[model samples]
Target: MKINLAALQIASVLALGGCTVLPPQPAPAPRGGTATPAPKPQLPAPPPRPAPPQPQAPRADAANWRDLPQTPGSWTYSAESSGSAVRFGQPGAGPLLAIRCDRTRPAIIVQRAGFGTGTVPATITTSSTLRRLTATPTASAAQNAAVAFEITFAVRDPLLDAIAFSRGRFMLEMGGAQTLVLPVWSEVGRVIEDCR
Candidate 1:
């Protein structure tokens, strides 16, 4: 008997379409046939890891540090050093600085921070305290220096060079406060910061 070529080709094309070409496989003879199990895949080993570079601690900027937030009725102050602390509070980071100068306190206490960073740099700060132009025959200005009060702050950090301040002997100049700034410097110390 001759097989039909058309039938054979149609069966082959249908098989190529992913349909099973044969019927369900029957069980092997119970008495004698041996079956080989499929092999397991062997994964490639991961490449060896390169040695990690040495870890270094991040350098902190002292003058750039910030401390506590401002409280109402109290002046805010911050230093450039991490080691620096104010009687009022700690130093912190900010462009606009706020310093509370106790009218009763004689000297600026925060200078201690500048000293620790090395010899604190000298600075020229101006005050807006109104000063009379001295009683002059031809002068219209006041006799006393009537200008807004501004004081200089020596600094170890260039970032804290400019000062923000409030003046009071328990009484404060609510709106108009003086500002201070430091001269250009070579180096500013690292500011201490709180992690928590």
Candidate 2:
């Protein structure tokens, strides 16, 4: 019998083809038990912080005059030829109240145009002091045109200077029940000092 080379090659190829490739498999479970689960990742915690401080409310009757809001009738100051004039209301145009002071004289002028004319009782109060006075209206051509009547009262130099420099609510009570509060700021002290 003669052996064929082609028959031998075909037999080798068929023998190799009989072996098949397979995918990888997981490890088999342990005897009588399931596989363990993988662990989850965790982040580190942040450090704790302290709380901020809270602001306290101001007490009643406290010297909080600087914190008060400026109204239309608040006191304002201006330089004059003789001295300084601390006024309330529109300057130059017509002021409701004006305190004109010089080295020689001190006068408190209250406009009687909007306020009723004649003798009116008025009180000025500060943080610690109270001054009661009477305002008498006088007629002048200048006063009549602008304020109708001008109420004039003489004020002492020392008292006027003290009031201008004080840091408190300088309240003026007039017209029976009407009250006007003027918050005296630090700038007012500078103005009064410069005038002197």
lDDT of every model, 2 decimals: 0.29, 0.56
Candidate 2: tens digits of C-alpha lDDT, residues 16-121: 9887677777778789899776567877888877788777543223466335454455567777787666666654665555655554545544443434445667
Q: Which regions in candidate 2 have their CA more than 4 angstroms from the true location?
A: 1-70, 73-75, 90-94, 103-114, 140-158, 165-167, 190-196
C-alpha RMSD for every candidate: 20.3, 19.7
What TM-score would candidate 1 get against the native?
A: 0.19
Colliding residue pairs in candidate 2: none
Per-structure clash totals for the candidates: 38, 0
- The true-versus-predicted C-alpha distance at residue 105 of model 2, in Å, is 3.2
TM-score of 2: 0.45
C-alpha TM-score for every candidate: 0.19, 0.45
